[model samples]
Target: MIGMSLLVRLALLLPPNVPQIPVLCYHQIRDWRPKDRTADKAYIMPPATFRLHMKMLADSGYHAILPDELYAHLTKGTPLPSKPVMLTFDDTDGDQYSIARPEMAKYGFKGVYFIVFNNINKNKYYMSRAQIRQLSDEGHVIACHTLTHPNIRKLKGSDWAAELDVPARKLELLTGKPVRYFAYPFGIWDQQILPELSRYGYLAAFQLDEPRDSAKPLLTVRRVIDDGRWDTSTLDRYLKHGFGHK
Candidate 1:
């Protein structure tokens, strides 16, 4: 395993030519009902639409890669499959297990799920511990989304441990794997927290639609939210334009 110091050094030395893989971040995977607010619908993907997106990726010959593969490609200049993409789910929603999981399976795709520790098993809407473990068992990467999905910029003192350390330890115990990746709550991050993430053994952290920090690109790995509102064509355009794909 690379130490934190070496990790930072390598990240800084990364070549400009390193491929920018498109990572799609998702939240809920159920239909948006009348009660769902218009603003909130962006995070609530319908089951049918999710299936269509998966099919599109499959037909387009896009292979879903996991974080370890992404890490290796970014840090060690390892080659990836042509048209590699990463599907990542955040917030531990139960529908991900019930709906998204099987749909992705149809295309032989796997995802990285970032769990909000406080929300797990809190109710029917959230994923339970057993389900999380099942994801790990079935070859999905399970990562942290903090203890309560707080905006990390406001954290202070022991707030760091309460949100990051405790939850990460619990996730590691649940999945029986090292929790080495994180997705910022609401895609918010700050430079000060980068050292804290490193201290806790995180090799990389993700944020939504933000420019990566040049000095610490690993800490600010960028992701684009898979908006529930987009059709397959629109998604394709975004993928191409957003990641600079031809």
Candidate 2:
């Protein structure tokens, strides 16, 4: 731990030539209900608050980059904007399309949406195929969340491949674009699943909090979860000092 601290401090002493894009993970965006008992409420951002976040990012000169642009910067030595960040949404929720999309567009930002195949037609809460295509056509990324939103760490080899590959194929068919990125369901993943992801031609995968292997940046990219707790000042602190854990 001491060595790691020294390295971080040493790195901070130097000018940053490479991009350090903070990937923000979000779930739902909707109006808050006072009496709501949903367990996923913490993942919901009120529409008005959501608008504030987008405005703050735009006003602060943060550039919202796409997954392919991020991948190129990380692996292919591509140049990024002066300030770059990735905004991502998980689950196939209707609110993401109806609420977040327009809000993001207001700031001239694009987002990556991870979808759960099973929820499309079965659950009313999820986005439909037509809606998903609409978002993709509008220049947002449609990536794989999972086929059924299962915990990949608990699945065997075949089941893991099915969960990763099936959704990639399904999304590609729907969007007519390659599905190159993935977000683990519930932010749960393990290094053992990397081979399966690679076999499916995934360029990168995202997990919340500390990455499984810090050296493998693409395979285990880190993200910060936002549940509507951030104001502009808090967001500034995050940008300057990180989440403050070390």
Candidate 3:
């Protein structure tokens, strides 16, 4: 499946003119991060706030597309709405399975979750296999972020492939489904790494960098890192650019 996909993408590469889609990256979904913990502040958000954001998208007439829609938009020249929002989560944090889903459910929206194999809930913060399986069955696209969430820009050869293949195989074996997406940890990427990325069978890849051209996008695309630091104001900036920046 992966080899064919790489060939297809390479065969399609040409002069640009594709419309951009916005993908929003999020971490933890907490009502409030305890002020005492510096890490918690960056990793958490109030549940009510997330609800508001989803409502904002719906109320503003935005449509959230699934992985396939994104694929179509890029590869088939499919058209999407003016405000197409993609909600994505990094790490298989348990709160997202239990808390975030319910909040997003209010708006009838879903997101793609990137899970790190090594961090599957050894601590109080991570998610368990059951929770991960349940969430995957509930319609969210469970994606890979490598085992242990290593920075791939520094990895070489088969070592890098294992980082990706481990979770992809694990998730697929557990879910009995194909794991098709991958999110690069910390938005770090090396363009040279893309060929291997394709070799691994990922249908699409995401990062923190926006595509240089909207028309002819690489399978690996950039998303806006959404957090409490910037409210709807930051999203508005992406909207203005006529690109799916967030």
Tell me each candidate's TM-score.
0.94, 0.86, 0.86
Question: Which runs in model 1 stand beyond 4 Å of their true positions?
Answer: 1-9, 12-17
Best by lDDT: 1
Give the poorly placed runs of model 2, Cα more than 4 Å off.
Answer: 1-19, 35-41, 243-246
lDDT of each: 0.88, 0.77, 0.73
Better of 1 and 3 by TM-score: 1
lDDT of 2 by residue, 88-145 (tens): 9998888898899998988889999988888786677779999999999999999999
Highest-TM-score candidate: 1
Least accurate stretch of 10 residues (summed lDDT) in model 1? 10-19
| Residue 227's lDDT in candidate 3 | 66
Model 3 lDDT tens row, 158-232: 787689887799989877778888888887776766777777777677877545433324555777666655566
- Kindly indicate the candidate among 2 and 3 with the higher lDDT: 2
How many backbone clashes does every candidate have? 0, 0, 8
Worst window of 10 by summed lDDT in candidate 2: 1-10
The TM-score obtained by model 3 is 0.86
